[model samples]
Target: MPTITISLVLTFATPPSVGAGGASGTLADKVVARNAHGEFIIPASQVKGKLRHACEQMLRGRVPLCNPPRAEQMCPQIDKDDAGNALPQKDGLPCCVLCQIFGSAGYPSRLRFHDLVVTDADLLPPETLRAMVSLNRRRRVAEAQRLFLIETAPYFNGLQFQNSEAITGQVDQPSHIHIVLAGLQLLFAWGGGTSHGLGWGDVKWEAWLDGQLINKIDSEEVKQICLS
Candidate 1:
């Protein structure tokens, strides 16, 4: 029988993909450039909370389950405090019975039960010579490499992403986030992201990653012009 996979359903009423970096453009230009929907597939590092929590069980080879907040719980309250301030819910609050299980396989309505994987070994391709070496560059992995493989697909929110084109963002947003110059384009000209110097794993890889990422963001101007 299949493992007792856990799941929670929540709807995300997100504004369509905005822009990335500090880019500015028409909304029409933003949508295709940003690929707001595509980013979710290769999500950023933020949604690993529940995954980390359930990881203990997953590591022990048990049926790891996930849970998170309800859609309603995600809503902010309009009521003000004594100082005429709004009573904001604590950040990181669980959205539901499984809210605490952010990475436990909730949100992302596309997820389903069969997507759970109780073991990690199934992800690697027999841990061969080359693959093992490549993964070792990072040496330490808080979680499995195939953290979001299809076997576990439809489990998490299927990957949620924040388009760089959004009007505002976290205080220390990466510089690449809002730039017009693309790393991907640069990598092509500069021998794939780097010229092989400094630090672990050729600077080439680092350069490639940096350039490729910024080239991907959209401009808030696009969302404003098209979406508004």
Candidate 2:
């Protein structure tokens, strides 16, 4: 297996409410996800899902891929026996390239994403609370009793993870690494509330393969391959 290390810095241009899964025990209706250390952190799952979505959108018309979130539509589709036992994938059946890299229910992913954390505690801005209300679509008015407070982390220059804490993964083929890089390049906005202009940010990243810096990735070439 070939090893890949990715270092990413995410800088939010506006206050973001990435949500801590749910309310913060009466503190706010929604809060930013954080690690046990109480420092704000973007979960690895979120990052991976976003990247997968970006890649899926890019490859949709160019290649064969299963529409996800629908088990029946996903690749490497499994079968079941009369006894309700899950059957293994047929030997000759192949999964889509995105599934090959991001994995599906029965397949394991080759790439691993790490939580993006604040690069420096001192650089963190103060957290703020904002009151928001839901709108009634029919009447185009604010709905009563729908007012809530959302906790947001102030905008910052960069939040990153590097060195031993960097994102680490293994690839079955060298070209798969380029696919992952191209996906990362496609990611711009992140987290929740993007439709309302929250969680808007940019990502700057560097990757290394087997301790050797990867200076460039020809995303155009990867697109061409997908088209073929």
Candidate 3:
């Protein structure tokens, strides 16, 4: 098994409202996700989902991928026998590249994603609140009594995890490392409100294979992989 250690530095140009469901006695209707220590964090699922989307978009035309978020079109589509019993996967169906890395039903992911956290508590800025209004699509106007307050994490520079707290995961196949890096490079925006200009940020990452730091993969290398 090859282990990959990744350090992700997220620099937010605008405050992000990475919500935690509905309000829980908080001042706003929506609040940012936080850890038990009350430190802001980006969930592993969110990071994985965004990266999967990026990979899918990049490989759409060049490779075959099952349509995700749609069960009927998922990779390694389940088959049935004459009696409607599910057939075993050894029957020749193979998962798409995206599913190989990110996983699908009955298939475990080749790579794992850890929650991205800020290691330095002092770097965290004060949380802020923003008011937004829901729109009436048909009438093209603000819906009456639709005003809501959402809590957002303040903008910060080089917010990252360091040392043991770094974003790390193990990959069953070392060859899949480049694909993961390419997807990371393609990812620019995260969290919610991206269209509204929130959660817009750049990612800086370093990868280590086994226990040794590898030569940094550059944008050119990523481009080649994406095009290949």
Candidate 4:
């Protein structure tokens, strides 16, 4: 049940004006919108679609890399409208949709909704596992919806319980933080997963995670129906 809050910081607001000879603008001004410690939402329909498609790709034994490859691993072409100037997405397509469940329709590129001030939704991963597990259970979606309301909650998944693992520049912890270090190293490293891999590590990790999901859902009738 490894989970992280995934406090995304992607901005989607408009960029700033250019100075003399296309110099530059402040990074913040250039950014359209960004949230470092905030939560965003995606339409239920979208999440369901993305998850199922990606999961199926994973099940098919291929890593599901998002289109465009670099920007977003899920949504594609988030630039502009048919006439330019960011198009109003259907219920905020590119941005995650969970944030609007609490009333964020008017907060462009903002979604602090689904308040977790007194809940465990954070720790439990915003019902991903559960949502994926219970689409068409033993009863109507209406019934399942109610039960979900009862069970849905916010939780702190961060490692706050343990003494914060401070790196003293040694052991398992490195002294310096390298940006995209993990991503770059694993981008094409042909190695097995954590279990063991000389040059097969990256692919092995992908394959292992892919195998785990289906195995986890082995007892899920809802998953079977949904994915079917």
Off by over 4 Å in 4: 1-56, 59-68, 72-91, 95-228
lDDT of 3: 0.69
Best candidate (score: lDDT):
2
Instruction: Give each model a TM-score.
Output: 0.16, 0.82, 0.77, 0.17
Q: What digit string (tens of lDDT, one per residue) describes model 2 on residues 56-118?
A: 887766666676877776766634322433332324565677777788875788677888876
Q: TM-score of the candidate numbered 3?
A: 0.77
How far residue 114's Cα lies from its native spot in candidate 2, in Å, is 0.8
lDDT of 3 at 51: 83
lDDT of 3 by residue, 1-228 (tens): 788877677766666778665767887875777778777788777888888898787777555566787767676774542244333342277566667667888577756677777557686778788888888989999999988787877656655532333446666556556677777888777776677677787777778878777675555644553454
Better of 2 and 3 by TM-score: 2
Q: What lDDT does the true structure give each of the candidates?
A: 0.22, 0.72, 0.69, 0.22
Better of 2 and 4 by lDDT: 2
Q: Give model 2's clash tally.
A: 0
Candidates sorted by lDDT, descending order? 2, 3, 1, 4
Candidate 2, residue 73: lDDT: 61
> Candidate 1, residue 62: CA error in Å?
31
Q: Candidate 1 on 12-102: residue-level lDDT in tens?
A: 2211122232234421222212123322221222113223333322222222122223333232312232244332222533222112222
